[model samples]
Target: MWWSKSKVSSISSPLPCLCLLWLIVPACEAQQQDLGALLTAKCNSWNTKTTLSFPGDGSFANVTERWTVFAPPMYSAAISPATEEDVVKTVKLAAKYNISFLATGAGHGYGTTLGKLQNGLDIDLSQFKSISVNQSAGTVTVGGGVRMRDVIDAVFKAGFEIQTGSCSCPGFVGATIGAGVGRWSGIFGLIIDALVSVRLVTADGRIVQVSKTSNPDLFWAIRGAGANFGIITSATYRLHKIVAGANGGGQVMNADILVPANMSAAYFNALQSFSGKMPANLAAVSIVRYDADAGAAGILANWDYMGSEADGRRAMAPILALNPPVVSISTVPWNKLFATAGFGIDPVLCENNVIRDLYSANVRNLSASTMQAAFNKMGTFYSDHPEARGSVLELETFPNQAATSVPDGETAYPWRDALGNMIFLFSWDASTNSATSTAATKLGRQLRDDFVKTSGYPDLSVYVSYAHGDEKIEQIYGRNKLPRLAALKKSWDPRNVFAYNNALPTKYP
Candidate 1:
């Protein structure tokens, strides 16, 4: 049995922001502090409920609870760690108590693997938000908790940039640690490719620095298996100068109405043709949506060119020729262009909305039909329930620059050399649509299964960060990387103190 306790004083103090550093301790001691007392004593705020209960708070809460969450808490315990020392203490406490813990940045993970902890300490690093640019070294050190927008703003201020997600709220460390991909792939590369180093607190509560030179094995693992290995405190990324006056077409193409009679075949053919001869300077993503108001279907095609406006026009000719788009293209600065890409989804809410399906390079062609069909079915599903906001199917193609540039064993992210990446995502308010929600989730998995069954696809290679809770350890860590990841886990986290996010098997037991 547990009881709650609270200490109140006449004078109130503001909460601390950004606690850094961490340490570990023996388990027995941590459990001695009455669970209820510990929570009531330290937790300034608390919300005890499922993700379905979170919407009422506008999606923000901070409560001390164990880690198994079927849904995100509408409220987030606002923790701002100002120093590395704070992180160390948190880790030590969690380890000593044998309590699961997870660190979150702008918490935009759509995957349940990130948000669903039954009972554990949630470390919100939002306060550690800071971005510094080193012009001479062409590097940027971003706080682990800093959001993509914060990074962009800082780098743009310093006259340089690196690839980042189109969404603004995702933290740099979490995204890159999870192999972040962005619109500038043709020129730059996936965010993981540019990563130089990371300051991490291992499961054992040891604060260590990892990079190509130090802890190479752990470094490789963190790049892809971020949460599985440790909590990254910050990341250093190699940056490059993005030429100014550079812009591309950011437009929405209505697929259902804009196309001529029965142009699905033509559309596919054109997509294949242009996609086959993808220009290095051009990057595009096609999103299908079901418009309830118009009672028709459509597509939102976002195109990007890293060089000049004129070049963007030339590069976009193939797509523009297909059909007159509803939202015509417009060019803007590379920074402003990315900002317009809509990266700023709220951290807490969107993090709970994550669900991703990964396909290997070999499966790209054979799975197109299954993928398209799934989108069509999902469109119908959403059409029936207007409240379930439209889903986003983003097909991102990686350039040879970063993924290919890095050697296979350089980092743990196995898909570095892959031709492209695709994500099938659908998010809804958990408070409502209980029946349809289950169906939509099942549909999402079915789509993945159908495509994976098709011949010519790469074997099970799921991104650890994007993994579903039901996925096996082998699925999250590819067959080959498993052994190495195991060794790393044993070496750094033998006790399995950090077994929360996409946990790696420490031993047979």
Candidate 2:
């Protein structure tokens, strides 16, 4: 899927002008002279047309014409900084003119918060991406914009491998700050769990280094929170040794049989059963999708096992015992197993319909019938929404001996007692379906709310990165940590320079 120079022109571009008037023009004269002037000045300063725009012509027209994309308004000049000085210069310029700025690496976030500044400078840090390991210190220093795959390649080359997300395109900085869950959770832990220090540029254009020793409050808050605190330039994380290519794979169980007629009731029961007999080494989740080519027929259940081939087989014996599988793929190496999960150089962008806290109460306390009932409703919803692809359920179990041992209030992330986390991912086309996309998003929210109520864990936490933007801030961070987070926001970004994100508003002095 790699593009060549000749093939580039043949491909149809989406939008040419990119709704410049709506975005570039500020809402008021004051904003115009401030934010607007900053943008124009920055674009002129860059003096390079290629740095000003994206490869695609896709713009506001695409969105108005039935694309539910939430691209930032004026992204004309995308500065690719290769060094920390570049970032400092950009930040200083932005601060001088009172113009909001956002930093993005791969821009793979589903939440619109990352790239939705009305009229601001976009600092694309892809060029700064580099990964180096210090064998003696057992620490790795990674550029903010380094893609997960690049880190993998670099760490692997250095004779060590760090746990990264499944998608290779997601960059390290944004992912780590926003809850870095991955395939190695059962043994290693989330990416944030391994972080030691970060280099950042604060709202007022002040560059600072933070860890347990310096600005510890900001350090703890930044790990699980989005980039509301500051712009991360680089990070130093602990490293681990990995088995190069451990044979990995799993089987798929039929959802119809597992989920009974009473959807919610059935889901709860299954949750209890699975929780009681949960295997530490095995990470599994159920998915629901209707085969459009097969005329809306029900197809459910998918699993991923990251152990050796024989070990994967032994771990999935219970799932296999559920019934014969419709599709089963296994291989050596964890990355190879995930490659089958669809992480190739595909042309289209993926929109995942995710519900973070599907199970509120401890699964062991839930009933099988309750779990079955939930699944039934989910199936019915899928049948109704034909465009909605199947849900990819994800479950990650971090080792108790690892970072989960950190107190709930210790970090900005408050969810500490859980055995693991789960996500119900549904993907759909980004083109020619504005109404369908909006409806599907609404449905996803409804599914999340219903599950929350059924599970009886009103306090269940949602990962800030995966959370819907419209959701209340307290829902993601929990009430216990809201005041502390707000104070940190006030201390670092008193003027709210990064307020455009899922920001914890400074309600107090």
Candidate 3:
């Protein structure tokens, strides 16, 4: 029963080997040829100004290198739509062939669930960048493909401001639909709260406008669960007048301080005390990282105040008293804050072809005991995996008055009561061996679990944008609202064509 390779080779005939090869090789070739023919036909049938990129085409490389490179999907083909009608036609064609598809704009989404989409059509919406500002009405209508930087530039030109994510690369529409959290959210509101209406192309290839008065049920679902309903072609949001300074234009005060490893514990205590009574106009975040080369851990605190330098100093007094090693503070124009604050506008931070595991947890308060345990665990993790020296833990205690102002049942976003959002970011080079990546991922998961247990919060809700793709639907959206979201999924996306990113099934388990 146990024959060696020598014995098998002694009895092998050339005809048998040739027969085995003939059976497998032609089948694979036929499948590839059929897919090529199908993609060719689809490209020829498009009625709008669209471009198609196939698997081996030169343009395919750029289309696929949008975000995290870990387990990137091997899409059959990509189509770039120039207009809203182009999106409608592509969706209809994909439906005709029963081919699942995903619409991508900036392609900056972090959810790992996107890797589940295999050999599907990619509907690239990056070409629909258009911005229109209604000065009299105090509103702005932006195309789906517009980025945060584009929105800020256009609104600032007209003496207006809108709530947007800290990063400038994410699509504005995509961020708003997922309950956008921004630096100005404490003053204005969450981005979703400012949404007036959205123009969407549904699964049935129909273009419809959704708002409170029109399609009220669908409107309620789209605010937080927008990705599951349809592809948004464009959106309109209410804008506010820029917070003008005493002289004339608006200004913001930015601060960055570095705390040595010895003072990290004291700094954390100060942060907890300050966060409990934070001002509505102030936003703060602390980052902790361990470096193997340096053989030490440090913390960085970044703060921004929407006022003059004097007011900023008064608000940041507690953090300043920590006596950090490095301190940099400056006052700049409202539009220049992103560049000066160094929070956004970094291209290399999110470079293509990098592997990362992002996780989040919501807590009511950061107890001293929990903070110490987190610091110790991070140190141990870094020591165990020297290759992941770039890992970090971010604690954001910004004032979220506008985000928490809405009632829980009013929107699909369920984490309205949480005071702080904790993010665990583990990143490493993709070329590392598989064992290293696997160990880093395991360590990240363990740290999150330990932190949640130590925090003593029974509600384990997480931010949707920071999810790791393994959490249940109830964990992201609360248990009380899962049935309703499931019902909406059944009514709108009955076939579940757009079930790629943090998918919600058509029926509840």
Per-candidate TM equals: 0.80, 0.76, 0.89
Q: What global local distance difference test value does model 1 have?
A: 0.58
Q: Which candidate is the best by TM-score?
A: 3
Q: Between prediction 2 and prediction 3, which has the larger TM-score?
A: 3
RMSD of each: 6.9, 8.1, 8.2
Q: How close is candidate 3 to the true structure, as a TM-score?
A: 0.89
Q: Which of 1 and 3 is the better model by lDDT? A: 3
Instruction: Report the error of model 2 at residue 442, Å.
Output: 4.1
Q: Which stretches of candidate 1 lie over 4 Å from their true place?
A: 1-33, 39-70, 73-79, 243-265, 342-363, 366-368, 429-433, 453-456, 507-509
How does model 3 fare in lDDT? 0.74
- Report the C-alpha lDDT of model 3 over 303-388, residue by residue, as the tens digit: 88888878988887888887787888988776777666644424645466667678787776766566666777777777877777
Q: Go through the candidates in order and give the clash count of each.
A: 50, 30, 0
At residue 408, give the lDDT of candidate 1.
75
Residue-level lDDT tens digits of model 2 in 1-509: 22222233343433332333234345422242333233333233443432333224343222112112343334433455656766777777666555566677666555555446654556777666777799888889988878776676566556665667645666788889876765555556678888899989888778899998998998998978747888888899998765445322222111112322324243334445555344544554443434455443342443445556466556656555544324454453443333444222112223222222222122212334444544555566666666555443333333223445566666777654444454545555545367655655665666555545544456445676666566666767778788888888888888888866677888632
Relative to the unseen true structure, what is the C-alpha lDDT of residue 460 in candidate 2, on a scale of 0 to 100?
45
